[model samples]
Target: MFGDAADAMGGMGSQEDSLVQIGVLVPLSPPGWAEAGRQLLGGLELGVREVNAAGGIELQLLVRDTAADPRKAEAAVSELAQLGVAAVVGEYHSVAARAAAARADALGLPFLCSSAVLDALTEEPTDLVARIAPAQSHSWRIYADFLLAAGHHRIAVAAQTSVYWAAGTSILRDHLAARGGTVIELNDLTPAALCDELADSRATALLLLTGTPEPAVAIVRSVRRDARLAEVLIGAPAGQPELPAWAALLGQDGAGIPFLRYLPEVFSPLGARVDAALRETMSAEPSFVAFEGYDTITALAEYLRVGSWAAVSVEGTRGQIRFTRTPGVGVWQWAWPPAQVADRDPAAPDRFRVLHTA
Candidate 1:
């Protein structure tokens, strides 16, 4: 059950859950993955409700819509700080989360990133910022391993200009290179032109390393229509296909495109309970992003008591949550939750199949 919620959109001036007033930054509008943001928000709301019901230190959420804009995220952080939020949490976009983390650090506000996976979230390591999502490098390397196992030695990434995309490309390139696989970056090409380049490259797999629906959906449509690329496998390591929007946009064409998702092969007891709770709030089964949201608050409640990210040891919906300093990661990180490569089933587009795990 959702608790007493006070959100900015609800005229409560930036809050979805109310107790101790925590600022929640998320993309609830266009140009961002609104579906993902909503799921994250839903999970956060549920977590806040349960925590208060348990008679712990009450927590309140001040929700701010980043709309996938870094500037908005920066300003929101400032506003939340002025409002005396204990800490800020939540963000679906990596770029926006990075901007929020920077601003949060500048103001000495604690920020626990929920779902963004950018490796270098901060310019320099600071105690103020911590993350729950597995870094892009960790997840992408596992994805690279999946590619190699599937016999895709030659891979091509159809990407646009973005730091997140660039970082993903680097992870794929570096991981694949070490395993004798070659990656081709197809940038600045029209969907039609991209198909030509993809077919010409002779890469057995084409990864959609671009943004949602605009060019990503268009590229998938073009590639699926091209008979020359029929045999080429399409993958989205950044998890575009995990959401319902991808299926609504591409249907059958969206299936078979493997993407990385953090989920266990078997759910823990807490995971099962949370999953059931989430299913009640959602029309479809919730994704790991939601679990990340729920866990963020659960962890923060414990962190508030311990006063250290590394000391945070709580039972999260995903598994036992513990923070550690991962190599090359600038913030306290939940070393990883279970990660797997999954795709929609071609027979039933609504169903997802776990293809590979790491």
Candidate 2:
């Protein structure tokens, strides 16, 4: 009886030792942007649960919210590190990502990011920092190409006074010039001033890179109010999902204007399958914000499962995820809409399709 008891105890100990634990750090309440952050956290949780349900992952997940503050981000990282997480995933803001990356680097924990677009996040690219989202520069290039291909030669680039716009302006300017489209006006415009400028530009197109949706709506309303600006194409950053207002406000005229977008088929069949699986498990829809979270956690889990520490590359639903030899600027695929299809369906924004490069 004593020998049988000993064997049973040994088996129980082995079973308990098989499980592995991983850390998932996210913003519980993203300051100024709660919805997007909530979706991100939801996706991460669903991904974790899904992985566990399928024969269970070797790693268990530890989750915490960063509150979207840089200081809080640092604290979250520290907390996760103290918990002895093998990897940390989180904080959608680029600034917050950078702060957490610094902390993760210090603690020797791998940090994966979902929504941070600023180029500065990976500036010091330690092995710890990897991103599922393409850099901001890539978005600018796609937007510029979209304008040029739409036969928009003389363009006006307007944006709010923010760092996001500042970085985008330089890249947009370069790409516009390269494509032989002159950026005739590059100014910071408030809601009221923006309306006045659009009314006056008489330019072929207006490219807006503002973070807030208010100004884009204002531009559309101003254009509708004036017939001269009616034919002028209006474009805004793809990140903001408030384009429905422009359509509702301007009706048919808004349909004629283009909104630059990346991953235009984000809700298509392929995307829908992934989204549906996540939703069914987590009870939420997926967004660009959540995509990074899902991909990062998936990547790290795969890395842990495969024991491929030297393998610097992985494939994500959005694009390639890999580390570059460069200390900063990890290698990633920027899946932009092909230039030929930039204005493919300006009249039907919802029906627009993306053409990927071969």
Candidate 3:
């Protein structure tokens, strides 16, 4: 389903010149988060353009579509390695990132994973792989804080069965329980069943962690339809708010439901300038994944600017980027991007507000 390494980079201009080649792996097709692929590509291309404009090293993106498949991810990394890319970035799925990161490690290449959030993705120590997004535990902590602040002493948790969701759910449940909070119920169930549990538990809040936006949307829709859950606060941790699907699917129902996202303050001077520039070229509002892609490239370029990749650190739109050894996650180092909780406004369905930062 793929060509040789030479064929993969054949369309790219000669690499023998001053160009610094970087590998871009993203899902660009159906069943592979194609929307996120386009957004990530936009951010990466924009970052590279800005860098070149500022007289930074010339960058050439050797792009590959992971198709959101683990097998394809492995193939993409192998192809990028054979093409001799200096570094890699941008993956939307944890399954794919894990497979691709292993390949990059075996080849001794630098890989900065953008959006995948499984805690185990960076468990072991290796210099080859790093991440711009926080693990499940970190994001869940932000959620726990929000619930605790809201006076939600009794919480009902429901999640998908994937390793990523399970990791996040466990962390969130344990943290909340340890903090004098009570978990009335914690289990995985269908949307309708989850709604029933939410209504029956008499919980102050329902914490829903799912593998994708579709499931989160379903739960929200279920909550909206059930009259019994009228006063129960709904909170979704991790990247649910960053998914374009959420906004499109939830509509007015999204109001009052807080979810974690990584958007910079839109009205702030720097944020306004950057967002405006991005809006000029993008069809959708700039998402957290987009910023992650932009920051990943920018961070890598800063290291390139210093003429070394060894223990390098750089400030980015998300926060800081530096590879520190992490254990029990994977064979790579990790760094967390800054994140915040955001909520849709019922008065303005198209508008959202940042509620808390982490």
Cα-based lDDT for every prediction: 0.88, 0.59, 0.73
Per-residue alpha-carbon lDDT of model 2 for 26-96, expressed as tens digits?
65563535555676777676667656666534456677666657788888878776765666776666667
Q: How close is candidate 1 to the true structure, as a TM-score?
A: 0.94
- Higher-lDDT candidate of 1 and 2: 1
184 in model 1: Cα distance from truth in Å? 0.7
**Per-residue accuracy of model 3 over 245-331 as CA lDDT, tens digit each:** 666777788777788876655434544565677788888888777777877777777655543335567666644567664544553
Error of 2 at 90 (Å): 2.8
List runs of model 2 lying over 4 Å from the truth: 1-31, 56-68, 184-188, 213-220, 242-272, 279-285, 306-315, 318-352, 355-358
TM-score of each prediction? 0.94, 0.75, 0.86
Residues forming the 10-long window of minimal summed lDDT in candidate 3: 1-10
Best to worst by lDDT, what's the order? 1, 3, 2
How far off is residue 60 in model 2, in Å? 4.8
